[model samples]
Target: MKIYSFRKEEGKKITKYDSNFIMSRIIQSEKPVHVGCMHLEKNGVIGYHQAVVPQLLLIMNGEGLVRGERDEYIKVQSGDAVFWEKDEWHETKTDLGLTAIVIESEELNPDSFMALRIN
Candidate 1:
């Protein structure tokens, strides 16, 4: 059995066109399997990027838009959770600012949650 712990720390201020803050707290991780919480500040964009591994995003607060490859987009609000596959390109845009907890794991259960990906 593996046990992981999350410790709170000062988040890094991320600026790529919008004011935002990000805190990466590792939940459980071992090589290909990684889980963590991503805390985002209001009106912040995570910028377009690709997921190296399968991941899940659970909206903790606020509203936002997720843009995937080929302009694929999805709207996410409070209590919304999204799943992203590996090697997929994606980005996040917050409408009214947001805070989301991200979980990346290889042991993803398809029937248990929303599986989202970009072609």
Candidate 2:
């Protein structure tokens, strides 16, 4: 699993036509993709499983702990994105709650768009 950032602080500032906004590019894929919003209540869990395709989970609200093949959980919150390669083992659970946008596809290349999370 890899952690990335989509926080406004890491986005490119848009100054076109006197517009004021920061655009955090998420993904650009020629291949098909699946996008969905996930809501997990307090102490909710998404059981461990192999990703059928590459997956990107963008934390939009709340926080959680995520684990990959190594079984080490990492804390993640809003604006944080987690990428898991196809067929990689992974799991996600939250002690409080979490709301995220999940994008999945066989051609995901998050590294090409988003930056790795900076400690």
Candidate 3:
């Protein structure tokens, strides 16, 4: 989630900064927000843990497997964002590698901007 993408097919084209850029509006939090890049190297894993607050994991590069609640892993790749509610158990792992941006906040609501992922 360190270097996510707009994918060209997603997000709206922005002409303000540059004509070739796209902007994907992610979140607008009234509460304090915390954002960071996560680097999971080959065979890396993020251990299962309960989220203290709502969290959004934005897959930036590579591919990975993630499980939440039901213990079933879902394949995720760049341009995918996964959200976990407070107190929810979740984990992430990769065979090759992946990087993603993690956003955490009590007021985090990704649905306001990004489409819900059924998986």
Candidate 4:
């Protein structure tokens, strides 16, 4: 069993992300799950990118705007959860600053499922 605290991890600037954006890794496992926390200062943005794997973003505090391939953006706030499928293009920006937990899995395989027999 393992426990991780976001406060313990030091934030690192992600070169690919816009200025004032930083991330701290929380957990990385061979089980396909990778977890991290991201902080975006006011007016910060995460440039458009595509998810190589499935991803889930959980809003921890503040508010932000998320945009997919579409031109429109969706406003999200604390307690909101967002999902992005593999290869889906997305981006995020915050005017009020935002903190969120990111969870992703690259090992998701639809072919590995086994049908269960039911009586």
User: Highest TM-score: which candidate?
Assistant: 2
- Ranked candidates (lDDT, high to low): 2, 3, 4, 1
User: lDDT (0-100) at residue 4 of candidate 2?
Assistant: 97
Query: Residue by residue across 1-119, what tens digits does model 1's lDDT show?
Result: 01111212323447777867665333344446555666666678888888877766767778788866757666777656566678778788885788877777766543332222322
Each candidate's lDDT (Cα)? 0.61, 0.94, 0.82, 0.67
Cα misplacement distance, residue 11 of candidate 3 (Å): 0.6
Q: How well is each residue in 50-119 modelled by candidate 3, as lDDT tens digits?
A: 9989888988899999888787888889988888889989999999999998999999767667765553
Over 4 Å off in model 4, which ranges? 1-30, 107-119
List TM-scores for all candidates, in order.
Answer: 0.61, 0.95, 0.88, 0.64
Clashes of each: 1, 0, 4, 0
Question: Which of 3 and 4 is ahead in TM-score?
Answer: 3
Q: Is candidate 2 or candidate 3 better by TM-score?
A: 2
Residue 87, model 4, lDDT: 89
**Candidate maximizing lDDT:** 2
How big is the positional error of residue 83 in model 2, measured in Å on the Cα after superposition?
0.3
Candidate 4 scores a C-alpha RMSD against the true structure in Å of 13.3
